[model samples]
Target: MASVDLGKVLDKAWADKPLAEVLAAPVSALKGVSDRDGELLDEAFGVKTVADLADLKYVRWAQALAALDAAK
Candidate 1:
């Protein structure tokens, strides 16, 4: 299993949470993402939780594009 240092990616309040809880946390639970940013994402794309952001079609497309670019 791959171990991740959650403190590096999540906000302090979320760092100690379980994976499922973290995934269900609001986007603001991520490091450097403000509550306002979470609100904007919610308003724009119906993205409420980290899982919602990860599952977004636009995010998947962008990730694929970035991977293709990196492979070039």
Candidate 2:
């Protein structure tokens, strides 16, 4: 299993949470993401949680594109 230091990517309040909890947390729980940004994402894409954002089709497509570009 891979271990990551959540503190670096998550807000202080969320840093020590379990992976499931972290994934279920609001997008704003992520470091540097504000409540307004979360609301915008929600409004634009119906993304509310970290998992929702990760599962968004646009996000997946962008990641695939980035990976393909990196591989080229």
Candidate 3:
């Protein structure tokens, strides 16, 4: 899978968006996520947005990577 830049995914425009609103957005909103990968995230893991991706219980690796990538 390509590396996703979470900062880009959760752009400044979304700084004040509600968690639920962020979670409801399509995975495609995430940088470096292809349409297919987005589908897989939703189908395989029910990951649909930045909030979902931040969930450590299901997507630990993603959570870690997001932290690192977003920090940059």
Candidate 4:
């Protein structure tokens, strides 16, 4: 079987433009996320994929929301 194309797996996610939504993708699927970032995220956040990202029940959403509000 061909290896999964994780990069292609989440192309639609980038277009959606929501961190909560995009976080559901494989961490490897993101732009600019070097393997180093992947390792760090997994270790620090238990975030191996986008679903983990969306599930972050902490300060991220609040921070993003604050940034968005500040931009207004």
lDDT of each: 0.97, 0.96, 0.69, 0.69
Number of the top TM-score candidate = 1
Candidate 1 structure, TM-score to reference: 0.92
- For model 4, the superposed segments whose C-alpha errors exceed 4 Å read 1-25
> Which run of 10 residues does model 1 get worst, by summed lDDT?
1-10
Q: Which stretches of candidate 2 lie over 4 Å from their true place?
A: 1-3
Looking at candidate 4, what is the lDDT of residue 46? 88
- When summed lDDT is taken over every stretch of 10 residues in candidate 4, the lowest stretch is 4-13
Model number with the top lDDT: 1
TM-scores of the candidates in the order shown: 0.92, 0.91, 0.47, 0.49
Report residue 63 deviation for candidate 4 (angstroms): 4.5
Candidate 3 on 1-72: residue-level lDDT in tens? 898454666655554667677677666655566778878887888877666766737578767789999999
- How far out, in Å, is residue 48 in model 1? 0.4
In angstroms, give how far residue 72 of model 1 lies from its true place: 1.6
Whichever of 1 and 2 has more lDDT, that candidate is 1
Q: Which pairs of residues collide in model 2?
A: none
Model 1 alpha-carbon drift over 4 Å, by segment: 1-3
Residue 58 of model 1 has an lDDT of: 100
Model 2 CA RMSD to the hidden true structure, in angstroms = 1.5
